[model samples]
Every structure is written in C-alpha cells, then in structure tokens.
Target: MADHHHLHRSTKNRNGFYVKMKFFRTKNGKPEKPFFVKHFKWILWFSLSFYFFAKFLNNHESSTNNNSLKTSIINHSHRALSESILQKPKTSHGLLNDLKVYIYELPSKYNTDWLSNDRCRNHLFASEVAIHRALTKSDFRTFDPMEADFFFVPVYVSCNFSTVNGFPAIGHARALLSSAVELISSELPFWKRSNGSDHVFVASHDYGACFHAMEDRAIADGIPEFMKNSIILQTFGVKYNHPCQNVEHIVIPPYISPEKVQSTLLKSPIDGQRDIFVFFRGKMEVHPKNVSGRFYSKRVRTEILRKYGNDRRFYLKRHRFAGYQSEIVRSVFCLCPLGWAPWSPRLVESVALGCVPVIIADGIRLPFESAVPWSEISLTVREADVAKLGGVLDYVAATNLSAIQRNLWDRKLRQSLLFHDDVESGDATWQVLVALSRKLGRSHRRLRVSSE
Candidate 1:
C-alpha cells in the first residue's frame, strides 16, 4: 500500500529544498519570533495599500439604496482618483499626451479680484474662472514658460454684473482682454514668438472673442486683432461661418458646478424618479420684441410659450427658482432652448443631472465632440419645429427614450463636461488638454523639432 500511493508530510518539498514556514515553531519545537511581530511591517504595507485600493473602488462596486451614502463614496473616490494620477505612474486616457499649460499670472483685476463676487465662479459664464483654477493646481501645469506647449491667458470679464438686470455687462471685455495681451506680450516673449498662435484664451461669453451678446453687434465688432491667432476656448460656436468663430477655437461647455450636480444627485434616485414630462424654467417670452429685426431667441421661445404655456404635460415656469436643479433631477425631458447664444447652461446641467436634453438650438456646435457622443445622447428638434415638441417627445418616450437616457448617464460623458477644483482625469479641463495635445504642431516646442 505504501509503495502504491501515500500522502507526504506538510513539510515535503518536491524541489528537494527547504521551504520554511516561518510562522511555525522552529527545530526544537521552540517558538522563534512571533509571526505577527516578524511580518508586522509587510502586514502594515498591505493594509495601507488595500485601504486606498478599496476606497477607490467603493462606489463602483457597492450598490445601495442610500443615494446620499453612494454620493459620499463617489465624492471620496473622485478626490482619491484625482490625487492618485498626479503622484502615481501615469495611464493612457484622460490628460492624454502629458499636455502642459502655463497659466499667465496677471494682476488681480484680471482674475482673482473679480472672485470677490461669489457669482463670478458659479455663474453660467464662469468657465473662464473654472479652467484657470483647475490649471493652476494641476500637475500638467509647467512652472517654466520655456517648457510650456500652450500659454493660458486668464482674464475674467464676465463677473461685472449689471446692477439693473443682473446680467453680466461685457462692455469691458475687449479692453480687459487687450490689456491682458499687452501685459503678457511686453513681459514675456512667448506671445510674439508664435504671434500668440500657441496661446490659449477663454471667451466663455455669448459671441466668443467678439465679447458681445448681440449677434449683429458681435459680428460688427469681430474677434480682436491681438487674439485672432490664438486658440480660443469659448462657449460660443456654430456650424456655419460666423464672424465670432473666425479664429482657431475649441467649443467648451458652460460652467456648472460639479458639487451642485453631486448634491442634487445625492437626493435623487439611481435612475431618477422622473415625474415631470417636459421641463423648461427660463424665459419663454409671450411677446418677443424685435431688436434690429432679430427677435428674442429667434422667436422660438415665444412660439413655445404661445403653444405650451398652459399645457399640463410641459411643466413650464417663467420666474426664477434657485432650486431649479432639483426640479431638473425629477424631470424626464429638459428643454435646452437657445437664449442670446445657441448654447445654454441647461444643456450641461440636464445631461449631468440625468434628464434627457431636447436640444432646440439650430446651427449650434457642442463642446468635446471627440469625447462626447452628442448625437447619440441628445435629441435635436429644429427651431422651426418648436410647435411639435410635445408629440416628438411623446414618440421618443414610447420608442427609444430609455436608450438615450442610458447613454446620457455615462459617467465619462458627464465627466468630460464639468471642471472640478483640481483637474480630475476625464473631466472637462482634461478634455481641453486632450484637444490641445492634438494641436501640438502649432506649439513652439514642436516647431523647434521641425527646424532641427
């Protein structure tokens, strides 16, 4: 029986070498050092590592009905993930190509001084502030101007709110921007070196670098000569040729706080218990006045008000509501009609808060098309078809609304639209860097390589 088969002792080694069980008693059955004492350092290392790894995965892995708890976990995860990418070995996606942006430190009047008014950072036009703040703290920010691929000129021109109408008075935009250019040009050689070709500026207002809300006036004003060669990151864009978008530009999403989105998400359900059918809260004029023959919102909003003002299906409100975001989270379809500009903040808020956006802007160019699947996630209704918005939404609700919402809820898409305090991987600022990385041929560093 022994010759046929037998189980060996636990100490048996097939390689004819001693494999010590350090935890076990040694030769004379006398205990060596205690296992816990010997392996304490290794245990501590693993414990600490597992702690961080588990924290990073907590929100993605665990499912719970407590949305507030889920939100808390996710906020923690976002912070941890943001910090990890800066210190850890770099990965491929998000902040791709290790893109570097050198933020120009102008006088306080150009940037921080405007932040004395809290609205400057959170308003619809606050991307001018958000991107600047994100870049200043990011690892991609190079301290040496010589090493920078692109220079960021931070000029906050939207914070000067009109005391009368509460709208930003951008009358000072051009002068301030030109002054910033002049200061940077005289102080640094980078501006003249590339003729501002490698420089980046934010024109997060209605008509981009033209710095006007009125399209006709904006066209007449045109992009400033000093900024004509620079790369503009602006909320304004269009499909057709327009004077405002004449320069090299990248379309950017209007600023909406990520914290605001998260707070709303905490109180909201997973799939969102959307009760309101069609949601619109902003101005829907009953009688749109024509200014220079261009009616308000091209009279599209006026048409909506005339048709659906009393329609119970469409939850329309004309007055201001600070908690409009809460209403957005509970709605099925959010109306993102045009205002002075084709693009609106609701487009980002609706997508971020889980409402299916029904885009009513014509000839509008959306931001981050490379990262965001706009056509798939959002439904576009022509400006002429404002009268049929109800039936069109009804058809979608009956047929493929679920599919659209699923696409809209993709975290990557949402991430690519909002700027956090620090640049998070796959967030809005990161997408900007990704877009800039593709334009490296315009950079001075790359030009030096070509000449060499």
Candidate 2:
C-alpha cells in the first residue's frame, strides 16, 4: 500500500510539470509567445496609427492658432489706422510745422480760361484743383506773402498747351507761360527775394515743365529760365530729364478721374481670387509720328506681345479703357510700360486697385520715391527681359506675392495715392505739402548756418 501511494504522488508531480512546460516552452526549447507577442503586428499598427493621429491633431491646432493670431494683428492694425485718420495732424515737430503758403491770384488769361476749357491736356489740371482745394481747407494758406514759407503760382500751363493743335501753336502757349512768370516776378517782391526758389508750381505734364517749343529758349522770360530755381512738380521725371532733373523738384502722380477712383475703391477684389496673372490694356502700336519714341520705338511692348500674345496667363488687349477697372480688379499684376513718357497714369491706378504693378520703364522716377517704399510694392523688369516676363513672375514665391498684395491693400498707401477734395493729412495733396515743407525747412536751416 505504501509503494502504491509513492508511485501515485510521483505520477501527479510529473503530470503537473508536463502541463507547465507545455504552456511555457516550444518543442525546440524556444519560449512560448506572450499575450502581446501573439498580436504583435496589430499592436504595432495601432501604436503607429495613434502616434500619427496625435501628431496631425497637434499640427492642426498650431495652424489654427497661427491663423487666429494673423487675423487679430490685421484687425488691430486697421483699427489703429482708422483712429489715426480721424485725428487732426499735429504740427508740433518735424517738417510739418506751422507751414504757410501764398497762392497767386493770376489774371483770367493765365488761370481761369485754361481751367474752364474742357479739352485739358492730360489730367494735369487736376493737380491744380487738388492743391487749391487743399489750401482752402487746411490752415497752411496765408494771405500775406511776407509770412509765407512758399509761394504757389497756379498757372495752368498744361491746360493752355492742351488747346494748341500743332507744334506751331506751342509758341503761343510758351508766350502765355513766360508772360505769367514775368508778371509774378515784377508784381510780387517775393519772387525777386528768392529768385523763385521758394515758389511752387504744378507742371505735372508728360513734357517736363511745359517748355516744349524750341522758340521757348529764344524768349528771355520763358518757362525754363523762370523754373530754374523754383520747386516745380512734374510727372515724367527722369534723373537726366530737364526741369525734373533738379534736386528741388518733385515728381507728382497723375490724376485719376473721380469716377474711376470711386469705382476702383469700391470694387477692389480679393488678391487670392485674382485669376489673371498679368493684365495690360493700352495702345500696342505706336504711331510713326509719335514724338516721345517711348512706345513702339523701344519694342518693349511689341516684344512682350510677341512672346505672350496667346498665353492664357497674360491678358494683353488694345484700347480697352471701358473695361479697365474690371480687368485690373481680376488681375494679380498690372503691366505699366512707358507710354508717351516714362510715367503713366496706370502705375497709380494699379496701386489704387490693389494690383501689384510690374514696371517695364527703365530710368523712370516714381512719385514720392523718398516716402513710398516702391521697391517693396512693385516689380521692375528690364526691357530686354520682356519676353521672359512669364518665367520672372512664376519664380516669385507665393509668400512674397502675398506680402506685396498686403502692401497694396494698405489703406494709408491707397489714401496717399488718392486726391481727396478735403484737406485730409495723408492724401496726395497733403503729402506733397508735407514734402515741400520738409524741403523748405532744410533749405532755411542751411541758409541760416551759411549766414552765421
């Protein structure tokens, strides 16, 4: 009975060991897989998927935060600009002090009839109107010439010349301009005091300061001699060009009609929605008798047309001013090539409509170059590379393009380009006044030091 019990106990022990070994070991002595190891592939897949999903969520949140921040900043900046515009301009310091200007009330021949005529040459007449409006509304104007920082001679030279049909008629306009200057010089003691250096005039025409006739040189009291020391404002200002070539001179923007300005201001489209890469609508073929030799003579526009005439990316049309506003609103960039002169009204129009301008004019002096950061706002292309305009535009990064668009959309920049009827401190007229004030102040300081 004792032997039988011992054998039974030994059998039980051996059976227990066999069962344990079966679960813990394989036949070749390899360890059996754990619960996790049994579904290793599924577990690994789940872990990887979870990691990726968490990463995606994190990135999404970060992007949302960034977008929100950008929106907040833009809103804040816009609000600040609005508040600043409503406030009166402080003339406590800098160049915009208690500035005084004296405007000459010239005879009807010099001013009234020229302005009354409907056929004004270019909208250069608008400069005269804008300045007059600004003077009337602002505290800058003075009745006494003795207390003035600058004297304004509001002679509508451009308007007078606009009525002339031929080159022979230019002599009559020249005589009128010369007589006006002579009258101002003889009547006012101010012109004699500074040799017209302190006098300001608007000659913002394609022809620099309106001395177009060869006969102007022969006349003793011509526009050229009178404007030698004056602070002349012109449109087509190159460094080497006459009248505008002087250091005291300023390049003013061409006028956009009230209708055009209002339409563009109201109907400006979003930059991202602008489907057309580049849009240009103007005269493609220059007349053989075109005196300026700026249009087809250089072959810039013709070359661009030859290369990109059929390109869907580029929209080049001829004499299509009726749909100009619509086209500019839908275009990402506006091509502003030199027309009769280096400067064109299209440049200012492009900025007003929030279209980044691609300037094709070489040696062109832009308006308010000192105050406006044009290089940051516009793109310059060489005439030789007109054919490669597509590639040049394509190579510009999306980020840079967006930045330029934002600059174009800036309210202050747009306001500065506009001609407001009232004396707004940041409008085109106000900016011109401010520029003149600064220049005059510097000249005064230099004179005082020289005398000392």
The candidate maximizing TM-score is: 1
TM-score of each: 0.79, 0.70
For each of the candidates, the C-alpha root-mean-square deviation to the true structure, in angstroms, is 11.9, 25.9
Model 2 ranges with Cα > 4 A deviation: 1-95, 118-125, 160-172, 213-223, 240-244, 270-272, 286-297, 397-399, 441-452
| Model 1: per-residue Cα lDDT at residue 109 | 79
Predictions in order: lDDT = 0.85, 0.68
Clashes of each: 0, 0
* Candidate 2 structure quality by residue, lDDT tens digits, 141-170: 655555568878876655644334522133
Per-residue CA lDDT of model 1 for 1-452, tens digit only, reads 55223323333654222323433457587647777888999999999998788775764554442233224334545654667767764444343565667777677878899999999999999999999998887778765566678999989999999999999999998899888888777766789999999999999999998998888989998999999999999999899999999999999999999998998899995386888999999887788967778777988888998999889999999999998999999999999999888999999998898888899999999999988999888899999999999899999999999899889888888889998998888899988888899998888976786799
